[model samples]
Target: MSVTGTASDIASSESVPTSFGEFQPVGHVMVGLPTQGNVDALIDALHEAGWPPESLLRFTPGQSVEELQALVEGAGPLAGFGYEITLLRRYLELARNGYRWLLVKVDGTDEAAAAVQHARACHATLAVHYRRLVVEELL
Candidate 1:
């Protein structure tokens, strides 16, 4: 089951070809989050691209992804806030034109799809559907 689409095309068009099975450091897929802020819509995009719901589970090459996962899953107080702050900081950095997309990665073959899905699954629970967005994955 492979996802084939323009979002996928962006990744595919890369002079370097990658697969949806494993991910390397800085190896990520970027998706255009909906301007409307709809996670389901993003999921639909992932579905269209053929990426698995839990596709962000595979891995490869380095401690970065793991560290990120630890930071995201921090059991300490204000863990969620920590991530929000980081994301917001990144957002600001990007606004300031100091953004590095590769720092935050989506290791799925269908990067666009994965990114959309990941963005959508930002703040929910297992019952809600956005819980899996923070987990690190490889492709």
Candidate 2:
């Protein structure tokens, strides 16, 4: 879950998020779009946010290819924005397998203010980024 490389690597991306310093991967992301319209919004938003394809992990309990693809498309708006967002799902093996908490594991260097700002932007109540954690909802 730790994608630690170099700063040069992040800066080199073509279309990068302005919140460059905030760029960091966390545990995982769980999204279930029950409708096509919702999927479109997510896709459009993700595209504008600059999400790296390799950074995402997906799962669908019982969804068709088309349905999954639509959700994937929308996920683009949420990636590489310097935030690692993971979802804990019910009825999933990982959840029952004892992976209850999605720990925000960091592997980089960044400022506190920057981290908090990134969390706010993502509307994340508990956020961990770039080796620094601004919120701890687990408490």
Candidate 3:
């Protein structure tokens, strides 16, 4: 899926998920960087590594904070029973601290692996792959 635009654009287009419930956002990886500069560098590195710009969506700290807060508040009661909720809370904390996020669409394991490599190289603070059945933390 070729989704090109700002975080708001992609989020509204439903190409990038605005929230995570149980087993949600399958086939994508969310990488969090400590700063906008780091996120930009990661995006550049990802492009150099063969990922198209269309496959990446960036979220500034303000956007992330808003989205994450809404996600937690709107989640179902059972959401508290899952690790997804915990991760959402953690993401909220990071967002509040000025961390930016990149949501990458990955078609398979190879793509996910490559994304993780680039994320680490760019000093990503967190990298989580949302698979069909599980959320795997890559860093």
Give the per-residue Cα lDDT of candidate 3 at 45: 79
**Clashing pairs for predicted structure model 2, backbone only:** 22-82, 23-82, 28-86, 42-74, 43-74, 45-77, 46-76, 46-77
Count backbone clashes in candidate 3. Answer: 0
Which regions in candidate 1 have their CA more than 4 angstroms from the true location? 1-25, 30-37, 56-88, 92-139
Best candidate (score: lDDT): 3
Please identify which of the two predictions, 1 or 3, would achieve the higher lDDT against the true structure. 3
lDDT of 2 by residue, 94-132 (tens): 323322111122233333333334334433333333323
Candidates' TM-scores?
Answer: 0.26, 0.27, 0.85
Model 3: lDDT of residue 138: 85
* Clashes per candidate, residues 3 or more apart or on different chains: 5, 8, 0
Each model's lDDT comes to 0.33, 0.30, 0.77
Alpha-carbon deviation at 90 in model 3, angstroms: 0.7
What is the C-alpha lDDT profile of model 1 across 1-139, one tens digit per residue? 4332212111221222222321122343422222223333444455555555544321111322333344334434454454443543333333233221222234444553445445546421111111234423221
Top model number, TM-score = 3
Clashing pairs in 3: none
Q: Which one wins by TM-score: 1 or 2?
A: 2
